[model samples]
Target chain A: MTTNILLITLVVLAIIALNTQKLRRAVVYLGVFSLISSFLYLLYGAPDVAIAEAVIGTTITTVLYLVALKKYQVFTIYFCSDPNDPNRRNLTNNSPFINNLESFLIKQEMEPQIIYSEKPLKTILTQDKFDLAICQTNQKTLIYGSVDDYQLDALEDYLLTNHGDLNIHLIRYTEGDDNEA
Target chain B: MTDNSEIITRMTGLLYPFILLFGFYIIINGHASPGGGFQGGAVLAAVFITRYLVDPNRCIQLKTLKTAEKILFVCIILYPTFFLFSTSASHTELMNLIYLIAMNFLIGLKVCSGFTIIFFRFVFYEGGIL
Candidate 1:
């Protein structure tokens, strides 16, 4: 009965770890899973394997995953603009808003990678994987940010408070939403 | 300056000697026990990791450790081939026990150094200062 329970718990933990949205939480789940598996190993009379599992699986891998997650600080930004407008070419790249945003991201300890794309905003939104997308149309700058992104709330606050004169509109959208913003 | 909590540092500090003693015990009694070199080495490596949690900026001699690991690996390979396979050496109970203990010790040291190096490299170079 105990073995069956452990096996069931192990399967449940593995599924939960796989489905967890947050990387940190997934790492924690994996740690728990390893701990339980090691216990199961001990129950099966392989104390050596159990000890190895307990040591390597529970501790080492969890720390490694956490460090990797911490080191991954790069934030990707996609800039999209109208292709036909001749003025769009010069206006998009030299914007003071982007410079400020980059500086703000750096201040937040994120390495921002800004990519200038001639593709339409909708195409970039649906096709490319981006943390934040900027669309320049006429006088207003439309910033589409992921709702799941923890930094979006702070970025919105910063933009509204500091750059009120820039006519920047922040739009929060969930992933895979096809609605035009 | 290490930003580690006083409680954590103190607790792990208290636990350090016990962890070291346990790792050594595993390596020494490897022939009679379920846990041998690799598992004990991993436990020893955990000591270094806990040391990291206590003081992130503590300097560990990685170059010396790498050299030691390589030398230990060579010794691990040579020791078995010389004693176990060579017909000239007589197999006694004491010698067999010594052989097992010595091999486990060498392997434990090698594994401990290797894991520590991997972890330190990830922390210092890949994961930045923190």
Candidate 2:
């Protein structure tokens, strides 16, 4: 019965680790999984392997993963929408396009920080510090990005190729305080 | 990374001697026990890791550690070939036990240094650079 419970818990933890959206949580889940596996090794009477697993898995690997995570830079994106639109509530829920973009950023090994703001595009551009500022007006999406950002070109290419039907117009600006068409 | 936390630093400091004691115990009794060089070495590596948590910028030279590890590797290889292969010595139980204990101790030190180097490299020189 004990073996059965541990096996089931191991399977559940594996699924949870795979399904977790946050990378940090996934790392933590994997640590727990290794710890339980070490216990199982002990139950199977392989004390040497169990000791090695317990030392390497439960402590060292977790620390390494966390340290690597600490080195990953965060990419901030500000998402703005017109406050008075009749379909404003729909914008609060993530659209398929937003999800796709987030996944794309994750694939590039970046942690995306998306902030939804109801402020005007001009105000957001002048007031906030952001890597990408997206404004949704009616049926069209306007993306404002700084020219100095190296990743902007790849992001623009990605959006143009994959989401051309969304009518995204990429606008480049010199700095945050000033906007030029 | 180096934040001064009273509880973590103090508790780890308190447990330092015990951890070292356990690692040495594992290495010494490895001939008759389940754990040997690698496991005890990993436990010893934990001592360095906890030391890092207490103070990250202690400035232990990795070059010296790398050199030490290479030397230990050479000794680990040569020790067995010289003693175990010799035909003149009688294969007594005590001599065999001594041989196992010496091999385990050398291997434990080698593994400890090796793991310490890998951990330090990951901590200090990982990412951003080639």
Candidate 3:
């Protein structure tokens, strides 16, 4: 009777782990699954295998999944250029600086989503959520980023050193500040 | 990762020595008792895992662990083969017991190091250091 219960619990945990949308929650479920299976192993008289399963399955696998999740984090950068600025026409087409930035973000293991917006910078900054926003004018490129983003520091250094010829202004947005630059 | 609560930290600190002693006891008496090398090694690994959970920023070098794992692997493989080839038909029980004990100790070391290495790698990579 107890064995049957454990088997049913194991099946349920496995299904939940597979079906869960969040990877972290799935990992936790898998941990519980492993723990139950290891107990089952002990009941079945395979203590050696049970020990290995309990150790490798519960602890090691969960940590590995979390690390993998961390390493593959995608950084979304929103590109919102002024639609009325006639001088900024063809800015999205064949822009070398934008291409370079995209490549740099890719190299850093981040997926840069460049959104070409006709909306004003104020609306994009205030209404829309984004990790970064790039506004292009005739004279300069305005890069808006969150102060809390750790990757922005490295990106700032990269932009200053590599694209020194371009007139670029970096504006940081902190919490509770809604001032339009 | 966040540090464990002060109560958990204090409790783990208080209980760590007992756990270590129990794990060693299991390893040493593996041939005669229910627990063996893998079980003991796993228990020992849990101690390290508990420590890491309390303090995520603690530095653990993986190179030494990898080296120790490799050494244990060699011992586990070679010693069993050597014993198998060299032992005669007489006094096989005594030889078997010794073999089991030696293999248990080696396996305990290997499992301990292997799990610890995986843990340290996960922590380091998660911290964006690797």
Top candidate, metric DockQ = 1
Candidate 1 to native Cα RMSD, angstroms: 4.6
lDDT of 1 by residue, B22-123 (tens): 999998888897899999999999999878878888799999999999999999889988896786756888888888899999999999999999999888
Q: What CAPRI class is candidate 1?
A: medium
Candidate 2: tens digits of C-alpha lDDT, residues A151-175: 7788989999999988999898778
Ranking by DockQ: 1, 2, 3
The top-ranked prediction according to lDDT is 1
lDDT of each: 0.85, 0.85, 0.79
Instruction: Assess each model's interface with DockQ, reporting 2 decimals per model.
Output: 0.49, 0.29, 0.19
lDDT of 1 by residue, A82-107 (tens): 78878876766666778888899988
In angstroms and one decimal each, the interface RMSD of every candidate reads: 3.8, 3.3, 3.7
Tell me the lDDT of model 2 at A67.
Answer: 71
Better of 2 and 3 by DockQ: 2
What's the DockQ of model 1?
0.49
Error of 2 at A67 (Å): 0.4
Model 3, chain B: what is the TM-score? 0.86
TM-score of chain B of each: 0.91, 0.92, 0.86
Off by over 4 Å in 3: A70-74, A78-181, B81-89, B125-130
| Poorest lDDT segment (10 consecutive residues) of candidate 1 chain B | B121-130
